[model samples]
Target: MDTTPPPSRPATLTAPRLVERLIQGQATSDGAGVRLTRLLTQDLQRRLDPFLMLDLFGTENPGDYIGGFPDHPHRGFETITYMLQGRMRHRDSAGNEGLLVPGSVQWMTAGRGVIHSEMPEQQEGAMEGFQLWLNLPGRDKMREPWYRDIATAEVPEWQGEGVTARVIAGATHGVQGAVQRDATEPLYLDLHLAPGAVFTQPLPAHHNAFVVVYRGELNVAETLVRTRRMAILANTPGSDGVLLRAGEAGARAILVAGQPLKEPIAQYGPFVMNTQQEIFDAVNDFRAGRLA
Candidate 1:
């Protein structure tokens, strides 16, 4: 007697964030002539709020990255390095040292100031990774400098339908990343999707989010994002998350989101301050041996 088809399951309603813009990273030399692709930087686009720069470095030639990033000073911000392959050794004036191997990360906060160097641990083989800069709040700009070295085993992995997401700096699907800097409340994830896989994750309503594809293609917000391309997603009203699907060969990308500080930024070289005078003070302090 019950011939009626069961009511169709309600389709999961996504918040519907769109790709507002797509940017292709440009090849450039940085850190003593090390080659990399600059993506979502202050010069390339608007200040991505609290995010300053994103660099993807990859090379098989030892000559390209062997030079490495030598002693440099940073103030009023943080630097995050995520390694996919190869090894990098970090040393700072504070007497801290770390070795970042594949699938590892080094997060350093240059609140007041810090001088550090990153050198390649090996001379050959393919090396690849990303470095992101996150701004500190005005109140925290003069705080103590700190660092966190996270090994691959420490990073949590979230598993969903055809997707494996490595949480690096935020919570996703009950998995929380190892690095935690409360000032910016950032979310960094490395995601891998199987062919035809669909993935979705919730984000803070006010956080600014973007996705950078490094391998294969992905359908993000109905837009096809290919390798070496970035998709800046719209923080649309009522949007609480993002949706992405993989192409025939699947996809891999890094998703980063953060709460904006909305403070005035005065940056010069490696220093970021709230005012031009502060920047001057920073530079002067660094030169006068007051910066640490």
Candidate 2:
């Protein structure tokens, strides 16, 4: 595979402009019935450029999950949910309800508005998933609503050395994922590593790149980042490899990159966009039932 970095930064997004970091934080959402660990937000938000949020949820027992997120509203962003071990049931005011099991992903675009509820599917035990909120460019806000349910087989996967990589979106190893996006060409990979593994992937000069190590340690550029940690990358690139390397056994991470929209991002709760007016409009639209 051509793991070649762009010779020069893309005019659209450059190293100095695109954001990256090892952002880390625990979930603190309102009255929680779920176990949500925040990997990026606040300053990380400013650094993500075109991406907004990443939340990891996991539980081996239902009681551990206080409950599940109920009906809520959102606008001007895309919520991409990926399942890892268990299943979750989803229902939207759009009249969509279904079960998502391991390997299933739901990409929902709440452009103008959408109201939905997410609850865990009961089984013997365990439930896990991640939700990535991707910002939509200003022009697409309120454009319309759409949904895509991508199965595990649809994602691209490749392996090398002591590590394995699954591409949920974007191209890697000559294979591409079918997941769709509205802004910033993005890549999402779920990585697993055995003892002492080294991993490398090229980034478009202008795209933002970061890694969230969920289970173990990642030595990025020689900095040790442990579990539940986000590693924001430096804007500089070199042969010493401004990259990430896994440490020890059972290390795993999610690597993401995307071209920066290079636009102001105004976000409130689950809504995201470019201006305060956009946030207001999104709130009004949801309250007025436009989400239906």
Candidate 3:
């Protein structure tokens, strides 16, 4: 959909990673009965280190999202929300507020703690988006809360032969993304490909990666990844990158990769910590009205 011209040089890959397995998101409801699919569950936390959860919410019925997400708390992690359609208003205890429209992104760091609410701004129509949770290291678990709203135009993109890549949080084809994290070195890309198009991305062999196709289908390493499916990439030795080919109907997908922290992960509901004692402290803090 992005008409931006292709970069002069395309990525080169000596060995492309293969799909380890396919995943189907579990149908679930959250945030006041908002229908959604949980792509990354608690069981996969260890496999997808530094990345905790990934939820996809999309619906045309107002009743499904009308209630939206009320005041909720989060700690010891960050939340990156990418709005694909509809408008949602975000308000937090830190006096931060923003309107999330289609193509916009909100990156919030609930380091120490924060209470926030995401409510729909539109009365009727479609609401579609994704929320990805990125874990915080032990050292930064108690850091101050931070938030940012990146407008649609701020997100950098790159176009090639028959594909367009929106770099959300990492470098691709020499184009820097809207947000970058030094701790995790996360790569979040939204790719739109024309029918039969081929796209290549160089990736670090150590990082954990996966691709979720939302529209049409994609072929990776000779594996057919259908729409609404996620393909977990194998971290094979000497693998330098990944090669993706769009199906006949074209495709739209999100490719995410991140360096593993390799640290112990302790989680309880919305609170995440390194140790059980830390989780207890978080619970006590929230109960004592200390968590904001």
TM, every model? 0.93, 0.86, 0.97
How does candidate 2 fare on TM-score? Answer: 0.86
Cα lDDT tens digits, model 1, 41-61, are: 777324467898899999899
1 or 2, which is superior by lDDT? 1
Q: What's the alpha carbon RMSD for model 2?
A: 5.7
lDDT of 3 by residue, 1-292 (tens): 9996545445778899999989999999988989999999999999999899999999999999999999988999999999999999999988899999988999999999999999999999999999999999999999999999999988898888888899999988888998889989999999999999989999999999999999999999799999889899999999999999999999999999999999999999999999999999999998887876
Instruction: Encode model 2's per-residue lDDT on 202-278: one tens digit a residue.
Output: 67565677887878887875678888887776656532223556786558888888878888888888788689987
Q: Highest TM-score among the candidates is held by which one?
A: 3
Which pairs in model 2 have colliding backbones? 13-206, 21-231, 21-232, 22-230, 22-231, 22-232, 33-67
Q: Model 1 compared with the native: what TM-score? A: 0.93
Pick the lDDT winner: 3
- Collision pairs in model 1: none
Model 2 error, position 270 (Å): 2.3
Instruction: Tell me the deviation in Å of residue 137 in model 3.
Output: 0.8
